[model samples]
Target: MAFDYKNSPTDKTFMEFDRIAAEMGDIRLVSKKELIFIPSMLQEGEQVLAFTCGVMKGKRWLVTLTDMRIIFLNKGFIFGLKQIVVDLNNVNAASGETTMFSGRISFQDGAIIHTLESVWLKTVLPFSNKLRDVIELRRGMKEEKKTFSVEGDDFVSKIERLASLTEKGFLTPEEFEMQKAKLLRE
Candidate 1:
């Protein structure tokens, strides 16, 4: 079944999420509720991608995904909050699993091994997919940048070598131009 954010049983929680989203001008609220505890934990420039509320190890917990990190907020009955932030760069990989009545998020250094009611799974599962995609995309971009830098350095060295060869009369100016064009194309 499709998850309708507007009509979820957690409508009140969504209201709180909306308030926080308004205050944070650039952020898009992927999902939110009292269970997620996002407003209090989110950092500046971190965009919420997905979140869910549930219980883990007998303690109430809020699991959240943001552009830069994955966070777990353990809710206490009184006074304090325990927060765990996993930067996206440190996450080697992430995966999600769901049964009829619960969901799990497995990632580097930690996992959200809790079960949400089946009604909530529709929303949570898709969020998990989106989070994984974002993480993979960031990793791919970093790899591409590294490859491009290496190629750029190689191109510069080749040009220098071609210039030296021309000066030494090992290559004519026409040959140098042709080699330069070939390098640029590659």
Candidate 2:
């Protein structure tokens, strides 16, 4: 069967892929076949942010980072295609290490550890760092949301507590009013 080009990467996307590969010291490191297939894997409105090629378990693979997740793709000579996906939210503690000629990128996803090896040192270090930064940012934003929700609950509880104190006569009405005003100011 002839391959369809309907969902293929456009010139701009190709440029982006090229740019990412260039950062790894070779503009052609990512094969055209891999680039052509990338768009088909993306969800609607999802975008490829960065990608690079590396080895995993002794096989060459295309490692892609999209707006939503990381995609690991390997096209085999005889067996067709393979893919591994990890959502951004599930990624934690990404780290990279480089030796003289190559490097490794590893990250934790839940209980599993995923590692990409034999990648270019220049690319692996920055890519791992960027991945860590993104995960940390998302975690920070999530924590902020939780804090805001808790603060909302706390504010309401403070008002209720002040009203309860007033009703029990432990705090005079005037004292309750002052506390309410103080809470509101806070």
Candidate 3:
């Protein structure tokens, strides 16, 4: 059956949630069974990387990190559901801090920042680290690609300069053509 967020089956447990998530795409269920509450929040092509669930200020909270986004689901009985979606591409940093009884996970995406607190430190700390690592890896790859493009532009400019020098008689046409060929090959 197709997954429905508002009309999720009550009988299905965490394992069933895993099955649903798997159906969307290849995914690693990083959160322990006890941590998952709103599995319907996950979207197609999103892979779960880490998650933690606990209580803060007498309310239950679930925070999840996925390849595509970070999700926060607040479990409230009378007030219904409140969900927050933070795109992984927008996230610049993820961090966590813990004391004896409470811990906080914070996410910063440009000018916007949000934090979630839970009483479970053991779960929060590791999840935070994993989340940060994934974000950093993504950022690094993007920066590397950007740097490569910049280098390509610089190479093209240098070739143009070489051509200009050849036109001004500073370099022979043969030498300029050879250098351009070499740069293009590299």
Candidate 4:
């Protein structure tokens, strides 16, 4: 059968809902901030709509801020904006892994800055628009310094942690043995 466009599981869901000034949108006139809540019908899954602006002319490109990632759907691909800077790590979940979502260009003191680490940001922006300067800033605005002093564990600590996981049967025998040997060498 020929592919039925409607029936097939498609991959197009995110949209920037900034129909403000046209839809009674809340506008922060002093700082040019604007907000409009998206209905559940727009996105059926777990998502967020974070705000980011594309500056060039007098246009607004609102960004969606969700728990996992930021989605940008730009209409004016060219002659609109070349680069985008998104806030990274603005996701407001209690304790979720960073493996889920990406693509976020947040406002910074300079341009939309990107980091070498954020994998998710890279994944989302390229697909939405072909801008190269798009940066995935993990929670740019409110980045909290890690309270834990430890950055990485020493060999002994690695082994001890491994031992604990192994004892709990979290690791297979081969994995345990490899880790054990590595620990001993250290």
TM-score of each: 0.62, 0.78, 0.69, 0.26
Off by over 4 Å in 3: 1-13, 16-43, 54-59, 75-80
Q: What is residue 119's positional error in candidate 1, in angstroms?
A: 10
lDDT tens digits, residue span 11-92, model 1: 6546655654444332443433344556455665456666655555566666677778877776566557787777887777
lDDT ranking from best candidate downward: 2, 3, 1, 4
> Which of the two, 1 or 2, has more TM-score?
2
Off by over 4 Å in 1: 1-41, 109-120, 163-186
Top candidate (lDDT): 2
lDDT, model 3, position 148: 97
TM-score of 3: 0.69
Model 4 is weakest, by summed lDDT over 10 consecutive residues, at 21-30
Task: For model 2, state the Cα shift of residue 21 in Å.
Answer: 3.1
What order do candidates take by TM-score, descending?
2, 3, 1, 4
Positional deviation of residue 157's Cα in model 3 after best superposition, in angstroms: 1.2
> All candidates: CA RMSD in angstroms?
8.2, 5.3, 6.6, 15.5
**Which model, 2 or 3, shows the larger lDDT?**
2
Worst 10 residues of 1 by lDDT: 112-121
Q: After the best TM-score superposition of candidate 2, give how far the Cα of residue 93 lies from its true spot, in angstroms.
A: 0.9
Better of 2 and 4 by TM-score: 2
